[model samples]
Target chain A: MPIRVKLDERMREKGMSLTELADRVGLTLANLSILKTGKAKAVRFSTLEAICKALECKPGDLLDFDEE
Target chain B: MKQSSLSLRVLKLVLTVCWWGSVIMAVLVPLALVYAASSSGNPKSDWEFSYTGYASGIDTSSLSAVDRDGREGRVEFNEGTWVQVFYPIETSAGRVKLVLLIAVVSGVVLAFFLVFIKQLKDILDTVSEGDPFVEVNAGRVRLIGVLLIVGTFGQALLRLVVSGYADSSLRTTGFQLDGNFEMNFMQLIAGVSVLVLSEVFRLGTKMREEQELTV
Candidate 1:
C-alpha cells in the first residue's frame, strides 16, 4: 500500500484511454482499471513491462514510494 | 482430489442417514411409551418390584461400574455391602414411562448431533470443490464448537435431573443414593479446542482476502 502507483497521471500525460492501453498491453480492462486505481495487490514484471512499453514511460515514472 | 471428493460424498450420505434415523427414533419412542402406558393400568399405589442385579450374577468382585457422573459403585470386600450399579430398579408399567422418557431425550440429543454434522457436510461440499477457507466456514466451525459446549452442559443438566428423579423414585426421597453431577472434561476441552481453531481459520480467511485484493 505504501508503493503508490502514478498510472493515472502517466496515462493522462500520454492522452491514452484505459481501453486503448489494455488492448495494447493485452490485459483485461478490469485488471487495467485495478492498476489505474492503484487497487492491485501486485503488478507482474511482464505486465509492468507491457504497460511501460505501451505508455512509453519508465517504471519510476509510473511508480512512487509514499510513506505513511 | 477424486478420492477426497468421494469420501466427502460418503460422509454426507452417512450424516443424512443418521439425521433421519435419529428423527425417526424420536418420533417412535413417544408413541411406544403412550401405547405401553395405555395398555397397563394407571399408576397402582401398591405396585412394587424385587430387582435382579445382574445379567446373571457374575462375581463382581474384580469389576466396578461407573455412572455418568463418574461415581464408581463397587462391591466392598470386608463389609460385603453390595453397591449395585444402575440395575433396572423394577420392571413395572411405571418403569416404562421412565424408559420412554430417556429414549426420547436421547433421540433428541442425537438429532442435535445430526444437525451439527449436516452443517459440517455442507462446509465440506465447498471444500470438495477446492474452496475450503471461506468466511462462512469460520462461523460454522465456531457455531459447532459452541454447540458442543452447550450440548454437553445441557446433557449434564439432564443427567442431574434424571439421577435426582431416580434417587427419589420407588423409595424414600432423600440423598440415600449418590446423585453425582458428571462433568465430561474431554467434551469441554474438545469444544474449546474447536472454538480456538475457528478463530485461527477466521484469521486465515482475512489474510487470504487481503492478499487477493492487493494487486
Candidate 2:
C-alpha cells in the first residue's frame, strides 16, 4: 500500500489523457484510476510493461516507495 | 478458463431464480397460515393452528367437555364423526396475535435468506466484471457462515413454535412427547466450514490483489 504508482505524473509527462493511456495499455480506466489513487494492492508485470511501453518510461519512473 | 471463471458461469442466473422464488414463497406461506388462523373461529386463549385426528365418542374422562380452560390443542371426540380436535383456552385476539408473531419470525428468516442471496449476487456481479476475488467478498462469506450457524437454531425454534400452535388443543384430550432432545453437530460443523471458506476467500482476495499490482 505504501508503494505509490506515479501514473499521473507519467501520463502528464507523456502528455497523455488517462483514457488515452488506458486504451493504449489495454487497461480499464477504473483500474488505471485505482493505481493513480494508490488504492491498488499490487500490479501485474504485464500491466506495468504495457504502461511503460505506452508512456515510454521505466517501472521506477512510474512507481515510488513512500512510507505509509 | 481459470478457476475464477466458475463464478461467472450460468450459476448466477440459477441463483437469481432461486432468490426470487424463495422470497415470494417465504412471504406468501406465512400470510396464508395467518389467514387460516383468523378464519378458524375457534377460541384462541392459546396457540392453535389446526390438527386432524381419527376417533369416535367423547371420553368424558378425557377432561375436554368439562374442564374447558386455557389449554390448547384441537381435540374433540363427537358421537358421530370419528374425528377429534382440541384447543387450549385462549381469547380469539390472543390466537391472532400469536399467529402474527409466527408470521413475523418467518419474515425475519426470509430477510436473512435475502441477505445471503444479495451476497451471491454481488459476487456474481464481480465475476461478470472479470474478477471473482475481492476483499469485500471475504466479509460477505463470513456473514453467510454466521447466518448458517444461527439459522440452524432459528429453524429449530420455529418448528417448536409451530408445533406448539397446532398441538395446543391436545391438552383437552391427551398430550405426549414423542422424542428426546438432541444437539446436532452436523449443522454446527457445516457452519464452521463456511467460516473456513470465508478465510479461504480472504486469502484468495489478498493474493489476487497482490497479483494485480505485481507490475
Candidate 3:
C-alpha cells in the first residue's frame, strides 16, 4: 500500500485521458482506472513497460513510495 | 473450473435432504412429545436403560467363556460396570416436565445441526459456481468448527445436568448412579481440523484478492 501509483498525476502532466492511455497500452479502461485511483495491488512488469513507453517516462515517474 | 462433478452433486443432494429432514424433525418432535405427554392412554410410563462404563471396569475373571485360543481367559473388562436403572414418570405433571425438558434440549441440539448444514450448503453452492475462494466461505467454515467444538462441550454439559437431575429423584436400594461427564476427543480434533482448513481458505481468499487486483 505504501507503493502508490502516480498514474493520475503523470496522465495529467501529459494531458492524456484515461481512455486514451488505456487504448495506447492495450488495457481495459477499468484496469487503467484501478491503477489511476491507486486501488491496484500490483502493477505487472509488462504493464509498467507499456505504460512507460506510451507516456514516454520512466516507471519511477508513474510510481511513488510514501511511508504511512 | 466449476465443481459439478457427480460425486459433489450427489453429496450436495444428500446434505440438502438431511437438512430438510432435520428441519422437519425439529418441528415434529416437540409436537409429538407434547401429545404423548398429554394423552391419558400413554403407551409407556417407565423408561429403563443399561449402560456400561466407557473405561474397562467389569470383572470377567469368573467367566468360563473361552477366547479364540480356547483358553479359559475371555474378554476382560476388569474395571467396567454396567449400570441399569428404571426411571418412572407415572404422573401427568412428571410427563409434562419431561416433555418440556426434551423439547428444550433437542431444540438446542437441532439448531446447532441446522446451522452447520446450512453453512456447508452455502459453501457447496459457491464451489459449484466456481467461486469457492470468497472470504465468507472461510467465515462459514470457521463458524462450523466453533459450533462443533462448542456443541460437543454442550452435549457433555447437558448429559451431566440431565443425569444429575435423574439421580436426584430416583430412589434406589443398593447402588447409586452418578452423573458422569466425559469429553469427546474425536469431535474436538475434528473441530480443530476444520478451523485449520478455514485458515487455509482465508489464505486462499487473500491470494485470490491479490491476484484479482494485480494489473
Best by TM-score: 3
Q: Give candidate 3's whole-model lDDT.
A: 0.80
Native contacts present in candidate 2, fraction: 0.57
- Rank by lDDT (best first): 3, 1, 2
Candidate 1 matches the true fold with a TM-score of 0.60
For residues B1-215, could you state the per-residue lDDT of candidate 2 as single tens digits?
33335545668768889799888888687778768676646544235544433233445354543246766555554432323354453566656665776677777867887898988888777767766678888998898889888887776665555445444544434333221223356987888999999999999988877777543
Q: Which ten residues in a row have the lowest lDDT in candidate 3 chain B?
A: B47-56
Q: Can you tell me the DockQ of model 2?
A: 0.32
Candidate 2 docking class: acceptable
TM-scores for all predictions = 0.60, 0.54, 0.81
Candidate 1 vs candidate 3: the lDDT winner is 3
Q: Which candidate should be chosen as best, given lDDT against the real structure? A: 3
A1-68, model 1: which lDDT tens digit per residue?
79889988988999999999999999888888888887887778898998899999899998999999
Best model number under DockQ:
3
Tens-place lDDT digits, model 1, residues B133-209: 89999999998999989988987776666555555453422114434466788999999999999999999998897
Error of 3 at B111 (Å): 0.2
